[model samples]
Target: MTNPLLYWLWLAERPGCSAKLAHRLLHAFGSPEAIWRADREQLAAADSLSRAKLDALADKDLTYARRIADDCARLHIDIVTADAEQYPRQLLDLSDAPLVLYVRGTLPDFEEQLTISVVGTRRATPYGLRAARYFAGNLAQRGCIIVSGMARGIDGEAHRAALEAGNVTVAVLGCGVDVCYPWQHEQLMQRIIRQGAVISEYPPGTEPAARHFPARNRIITGLSRGTLVVEAPKKSGAMISADLALEQGRDVFAVPGDINRPNSAGCNACIREGGAALVQTPGDILACYAHPRQPGAPRARKPDVRQEEQLHLDSPEVFAAAPRTMRTLEGGEPERTVWQAVHSGRHTVDEIVNETALPASDVLTALTILEVGGYVLRVGEGFCAADDVQLPQQTNEEPNLG
Candidate 1:
């Protein structure tokens, strides 16, 4: 008996066979097996199979497919065909969806879950990293599956955040699932495989290449209902993902960043050109979906409409004017003191620790909470209070630092 996957693997590995052409053939022939059985006359009847593609499809050599299947079996990897029951239904919506997916872990029911793709530059800033963690972690906590490329900087941070939140997160790779592209993320890849999935269209043993990434970006966005860009330069892969998300009819959300920063240029441009929604918090993303939550699941927080309207265009002055509220100010002891220190012009972490006389660890934790809550923004090596955040009156009683 012929293995059904052999046909898919053969079709997927065929030269000059673009995803569009493969999809067209699938539409015409119904299945990979049927397409395999198609004769020259039948292949000619298909819509857009060029002579070269037809010839490539006609070769039908199973050598590579058999080797890949053997490798996957040995490595415990699963080959998910486009027609498989576990294949992401979201990817099927794309005109150029992959015919075969190499999966290293379990796949979630994508149709029943809210999946968001978080993408940004590999050279991410402190602010961008914090924003990525804040949004990705919160979204995961709220039952949204986090998806990213698992590259360094923002992508790595996003994946880490989701994993730290103890939720499922998917990493779509440019290389094969068996091969970790950035050697640094080998550990992260393993963790994702244990908790979620690391998936790729390329067969096992395929090495990373420059050309594979842009094509990889499509799958990253294709698997999600929305894509969140934390920070990206004018011409970056994150920008490409944002554009692909729009083209795929998925919502694109961008975290607003300083207009002067080159890393922020793409996100700012997306908002300015009305290509993406300006995201201030995870709530802004959840608000867009507004789907019913699972029993006992956290309710999606609605975004502040007035504030969103003011900052819709992502104007620098508007952002500076509409400072985020220090919501956690009244919640804790050291946080209030840390906020007071930053508010009183104590910039760096050391300065805040010295001023508050709190342990560096405590001060750092408080500052992180403050920053992620939008009460403060990291500027260079130091931090500053958000502009226009009304400061509370000084209290005679000191915070309970003990």
Candidate 2:
């Protein structure tokens, strides 16, 4: 019961301590008391840890661990360990899942026949905003729990739409349940907690760091049945969720963007890669929900192990201090690559990642921005292409991501 406190304490005192290592120690030794009771030889011999790891958990760290456990008992924040039934089965597919989930609200129903993640850039344009609201409204009307980051632009629009539509929604957060990041979304997050829920694995009082977002995206997709991208740039975190969704055997959908606009690139490229489904309306997503979604389905045969282990910039410095770059500002990838090959032309997400070798999460965001900006467009399941020079539409409202 107090292991959460012990683990948090162990982590705070020992910087560079691995969540994976901490999780395993608690699992194997039964409790912090047992772990502290074990001699250096026993802790060092563990397959889960290196000698460096063993040394970091010195006697002083153990005392702090006990204190943390006591604090958890006092606060009553629910601690979900890996073995717990509430650990969220979807995250188990990840190569490195969070060891514990410090949850404040009720966990959404994974057994829901329809669970869809709607994600996009925080600085989305007008088109991105309309698309998010339209898609969220469409899906919510059909009884799907809308999942998203309570970010600005598309994510904010999605939550609002879900609330307006009078349906449940879930906001997967990058910080602790007690702390609200970005400040602007505080009101929306409170609303989300009242209806669907607000969830995070980060411990209480943990600051919302840049590195936490990409990792947060994993849990967003992991908790849902599928993910939909309304907008994103090449380097946006929204794409990270899409990539993870594809790997988890969850369907991915994207709203196309203008080729001239940068924000839609990550989403556009995802469609091109066959890693996601092309969606233009809520029906496109609703169609998948129409057929009974098989929750807890087994994964496909093993693909590239590294393919799934895509990098998400975990450095605190990256999140805390890195200035927004051109790629982040531009946001979209080219869409003409869909027919070229899985990794084919016009700066497709997979190809861009192959060429520039940027992380998948980074590349995916670019595609999203492109889609929302109308730079690229999704055609069908995880497929995207540049707008084939069609006559421009002057429509103000969104067409909906079906």
Candidate 3:
């Protein structure tokens, strides 16, 4: 358990040895202990084993192997080798999944559950932040544990909002689970370790680098049922995660943003190219879950306009979904963030949330209503605006997109 595989992974840490080589070794050797016991001729005879790797396989790499063994012993961390019941099934679906996963806390129910990965740019706008919070908060209430990188803007917002809702959130850190990057979110990291979990593939003391984040992004989207991109520039880390999510057979949801806004390009492109679904609110996501938590109780909303808007979007079968708060807006109800977040100027979910201080779930409900009425348009990355016709803020006021 603590020999060749650990050493190879440690050598994998040394720059250019690919995880593919690690996999090949796992396949041929059967186990780390077996690979370590193999003589030099036996090592040389192994097919597809790179010369650089084979040469370093002798006593040279033994010390590092022993040290990692000692480190794991001291930390009491369990290593989930590939194909175990404890291994994350979501990862198995990927073609090049990691050979071993080092987990520090209780793993979530990946086999029976569908985790949603929400990611976005680090330099997020107020709207991006608010949208992340609202989505995380509402998703948590709906019994969905949010997954993010724990970077400053959208990622941090998602984790914090989930925690605030008295739920768990998983942070897939680029560095070691015990380390915190950017320093600003250190306090938040502690909270996550207490309420949820922080995980990484890097050894316990590794620091983060630009290269680590892309691989880290893969884990964030790979381990979940889906991925949501809230806000991103044309060149953003969020887009990379979105790409990986698609490659992993996970659903991709991108919040639309303003075309004129430079920060929204990635999300807008995703929506246009059909790489992602245009997610207007949390309801849209929860509906995808097998057994949604709250299911948005009807009693919480007002009867008139909300109910009528439901009628507008309703299939002929249902007739009227229910008497909810959305029916009151003149042009339509604020049914989803696509419609609700748009005001005199384009607004982000954060602006809406801070001004209204409403939970994102309620905001999602309102946005759905307005979107049905055609009063607003989802321009890009949670940005919404009057759709050529500004509907007056009606008696059915939209909740702020906090």
Candidate 4:
């Protein structure tokens, strides 16, 4: 008799046997062994597989499948099927969950762990990079396992920060578990394997493909209790992850960014559409896990890092200070004059334009600069001093992107 696990690998590798179709076959036949033993007539009766696929499954040799399993063992990788006890329970909730995960490091008890995915675009701004690090570090210190796509920019920053805090971080890859796509992240991948895990549904030696990424996203969001978008454009893979998380009933958090920055537009849109919560600090994310932790998992009672000075965007003093060398704004006079108008109870664009006596374009430009600079907040129907915006304390000089 063939090894039951080998049958699973063969069935999974069979051409045209999509994840959904494989699942249907499993549900109908009880197990991979049963599915393999069934004749073409029985499979056709299942109605989900095409005749060509059924023939392909019936005729394919297990040589390549066996080679994949052997390669995993040679490289110290583990093949975890959906039916395995080590499989993450969160993934079971996904309708199109992968049948197996090629794991290069230890798999955590996702049911017993607090997991959150941090995702964003490759072209992240300094603001987005900092936000990713701050949130990932604070959450990791508090015992939440950070999950990400292991891509460049935000994802890499989040994983590195989490590991730096001596916490577990899982990287769900778009390629095979053994292959590193970015190549620059080879060293980073090693660090993660030492401290956390690198997992993928694609078998070893599989190259990263365009189609694999969106499918890769479901697993990232699927494994976590929540997904955080640190920065993204109006349309990007990060938003897809956010959408997938929401569909999976996972909490979605978007770090507020400058309104004028294109990198932040997607996050801002998500907030405006009521699709995600505005995340100002790690505390905002921590609050989402209101449910009790896993029975055996210990929650960190003491703060991991010293509480830093908090700054709200709407602080009157902050808005009052006229920066002598501000470059993001057109001129000091326009910004200060506009700030005073809003501070003095002029709310709407028309109202501020009327009161400041400045041209409509100038008011609009200043408002964009002010909001981006974190000096003003867009409340419902009106603008206000950004007094409620909370940001982590300052230590290093702010990056000069200009």
> Model 3: residues >4 Å from true position, as ranges?
1-15, 39-45, 72-78, 290-402
Scored against the true structure, residue 252 in model 4 reaches a CA lDDT of: 89
- The per-model lDDT (C-alpha) reads 0.84, 0.66, 0.68, 0.80
How many clashes show up per model?
A: 0, 63, 33, 3
* TM-score of each prediction: 0.74, 0.66, 0.68, 0.74
Worst 10 residues of 2 by lDDT: 311-320
C-alpha lDDT of candidate 2 relative to the true structure: 0.66
Candidate 1: clashing pairs of residues: none
Clashing pairs in 4: 313-386, 314-386, 314-387
Tens-digit per-residue lDDT, 208-250, candidate 1: 9999999999999999988999999989999999999988877
Put down candidate 4 lDDT per residue, 1-402, tens digits, no spaces. Answer: 666778888877888778888888888999988887888888888866667897886874789888988998899999999899999988988878898899988888887778999999876654566678788887888789999998877898899899999999999998998899677678889999999999999899999999999999999999998889999998999999999988877778887777877878999999889888876667666654654557556432322222322321222222123334433323377887897787555767888999999999999999988888877766434466443333334379898899
Best by lDDT: 1
Model 2's number of clashes is 63
